[model samples]
Target: MPAADQNATPPGFGITLDTAAAEPRVVVTGELDLLTSPQLQEALAGLIADENSRRVVADLTGVTFFDSSALNVVLHAQRQAGERDVELAVVPSPAVSRVIELTGVAEHLSVADDPRP
Candidate 1:
């Protein structure tokens, strides 16, 4: 069999993780959709599994796009965290804040400003 292209990106277009935790903080910056949702999913899974982490903050400042699939991923993460008795915050960027508000999911999330440098 032929070897697959190594440099080529995976099925997802743009999905990356940046862990910024000063004691307790998880900043995720990237686009999440049908393709890249798994990355976020994995992060959420890891957080909820950690008993010491009481809060999980998702920094969406770098994300310029949003869709139903992305929303679903977040919602699922919310539920997962809730089940584990953890708090989930959605730190929406100025760009994505309006869309999240319009979608009516903002109320449920702990909407905060992006603390990016």
Candidate 2:
């Protein structure tokens, strides 16, 4: 693994996939809505597909805004991680956590203080 780098910015969103650590970290910034959910989905899917992947941490601390579509993407990633036997944790910003708590998905996914390894 190398150092962390800016991976992509898809329209209204930006994703930084840090693969240098033991468990890859995907940090999402900007608005996570209908237009940006797929970017996150693809990034997470790519991380999960790696056989070397043991776990993946989604750091949503940079997210300024979040919506149900983004939450849906996280939930889907959680399920995929489970099937792959890969641990998945989420570090949510206040805005993101509020939505997660409201939707009761927080209990289903591991919420961590640190998203880094």
Candidate 3:
């Protein structure tokens, strides 16, 4: 029997912060699962905690995979943003849209088709 390749690399994951725009944006890319969700949660928490932050845009358009753990992070962030009187908008990619639609979280979250007006 052949064994799996030990040198195989895992899917790439990244998070970037962009505050140049009027609204602070967190741009996420690559796969998002239980292992990577915490990074996302932390990023969102930081933005929501900031007193100067009035609005935040989570640009998940580059994400290739979004699992239930990722969904939970987003939902938690949304709730925190609300409590802080901050607006949270999510720009989902096609891959993410399917999960949001199937989970019916679109109504609870501020889902935007585009990042800009």
Measured by TM-score, the strongest candidate is 3
Candidate number that wins on lDDT, 1 or 2? 2
TM-score rank, highest first? 3, 2, 1
Candidate 2 lDDT over 42-81, as tens digits, reads 9999999899999899999989899999999999999999
Candidate 3, residue 31: CA error in Å? 0.6
lDDT (C-alpha, whole model) for all candidates = 0.67, 0.87, 0.90
- Looking at model 2, residue 12 earns an lDDT score of 51
> What's the CA error at residue 38 for candidate 1, in Å?
1.4
Q: Against the true structure, whose lDDT is highest?
A: 3
Q: In model 3, which regions exceed 4 Å deviation? A: 1-10
lDDT of 3 by residue, 32-109 (tens): 888778888989999889999999999999999999999999999999999999999999999899999999989999
Give one digit per residue, the lDDT tens place, for model 1 in 5-99: 65455532454444446424445455555566666777777876787877777777667666677778788888888888888777776556867
Question: Which candidate would rank higher by lDDT, 1 or 3?
Answer: 3
Give candidate 2 regions above 4 Å deviation.
Answer: 1-12
